[model samples]
Target: MQQGSLARYKLYPSSLLWLDSLSQAGKDLRARCCQIQACDTDMVKGLAADAHRLLARGDASGGAIVLICLADRCRDAGELVLAREYCEEAVSHFSCYDDCRHAHNLAVTYYALGLVYQSLGLETDAIGSYDRALEAFDEARSQWMWAHECAKRMMNECDEVVRWIRELRQGLALGQPAPPLLTGTLVKIPMWSTSAGSLLRVREEPVDWVDVEVSALGLANFALLINGNSMVGLGVQNGDVVLVQETADWPADGQIVVVRMDRMESESVLKRFYRRQDHICLEPANERYPFLIVLPNWRLKEEVSRRYAQSHPERGLEFFLESSVHCVGWYCGKVG
Candidate 1:
């Protein structure tokens, strides 16, 4: 296709969304679909010809598989625009079907699409594509994973691919400097946290949950990811995963713990817990940062309110500090 002619199909501006294809789900399916297995230039050219023939013959599934294989290669070779074009055409023919094979194909296509966006530095869009991939993989795994011989052979790899996507999505959310690839041998743990001061609901899935390898300290009930240098004094560095043991009781003097203050149930923060004769302190690990000290009375809140009243009167009436500090969990140790 010529450059001027390419602009006619306007779905892709700066050339996005052309990728579509299937993973090597089963040997039988590929054999049945023109046998264009490898990504070599000659092979891909032949595959393109076969893809057209298959589509002309009304074999939508086979055609999509070939297009996606081509897309996958284009992605690998840094031909992102071409990759998306192949994927888009693949999408035009097939998205999903009741059959498990179609679902597997859809999953692979979505994964490839995610890679395109990820390489383009579009983290949010890449995450969305991976989400779609997970959905398709879920459907495929439920009934087809072990049923067909070819599908069975590909199950483990499919699962690992999904896990890898999850890892990528999460690391991006946390702004991880480097995301480690954990082998299958390690136990995966569900995390309930927010880095620094954000909110993540416990009921929902991980776009937040992180995994860690169990150490001599034993397995933590939950985990949190350190996102900033604020916790450096506590030996928790950026990108480190902090394992926490869930506990109702507040930490004894000088112990580190996770806590939610002022009725912010969804948002949790980590601090050094200490108790005094009259007040309790949720001390920040770094002294340079502000300390969260619960004063003996409403003096702290009153002083701030008095200053604010000179400018805004309405908010002063509405503002009330609720010091209901709820302990979330005890910090176990750091794991990266």
Candidate 2:
């Protein structure tokens, strides 16, 4: 056997003590035992058997702790299904002793279950478990100082996680082309006053969601409202809703795209993307507006001449690919 495998199978002093005094062990010892079990995959079945025996001997708390340990071990090993099963068992056992005395343990069990669910991508279920954990921690706060601090920290963390999950769902909804179609709000792209032309500005104004038929279009399609008549050459007009297909893949040469320049600034524009041997060009449809270019090795905050005369000059505004300029998506077709 490999040295690492041998080390895992090697019995420690605490390993024997765990089997004999599991019921009397504190949370620290239970946690240590779990860590040891996680290192040695060979002993997992034996540990489960011992936990069952402990349950048979009327040591529900000890059995539950063992199961929780097993779950943590499985989770670390990427055995998600087994980890979920063990967490479910642990939750059941902890539920039986949901009194104030066992509140801390119950809360910890619920939190662990929540983590497992989160890892499995079950966001709703994870949020539910986190809520249960917070409730249990709330009840135990008076008894334990740590529980109060943990509860407070978890409350903030859970709120952020829930918000993130909602945002993620909304983003995914935008990419789903299934029946019972999804709707997206069309936000206007603000224009910035610049010498070159009316450059796009980033704004956070809220817009009402509008239902657009996207079942015919493939998944990953979104809607954006045209603000400027720059793309009037391509039959795209102001106030028209244009469908955009989201992708990280490079847009084909001459394809229209929604692009943002300078990550720090929220300014974005709809332009025809073109790549030269040395630089990238974002061309507007209207000849009245000069196109933007990012030169090689351009640094941030470096003043680029705002003058329209210097807009397409030999050495003008330089931007770094990916860092300074980002292509959000390719334009599909106008909706309305």
Per-residue lDDT of model 1, residues 183-274, tens digit only: 11234555554554232333345445443432211224467766555567877766777777555556556667777655555556777777
- Which pairs clash in model 2? 294-319, 295-318
Residue-wise C-alpha lDDT for candidate 2, range 200-311, written one tens digit per residue: 5645652433343322222223556667777888887777766555444446567677776675475677887777655677777777666666556554224444443455
Best candidate (score: TM-score): 1
TM-score of 1: 0.39
TM-score of 2: 0.37
TM-scores, all candidates, are 0.39, 0.37
- Runs with alpha carbons beyond 4 Å of true place in candidate 2: 1-197, 204-206, 298-322
Every candidate's lDDT: 0.56, 0.54
**Cα lDDT for residue 269, model 1?**
71
Number of the predicted model whose lDDT against the real structure is largest: 1
- Cα deviation in Å at residue 227, candidate 2? 1.4
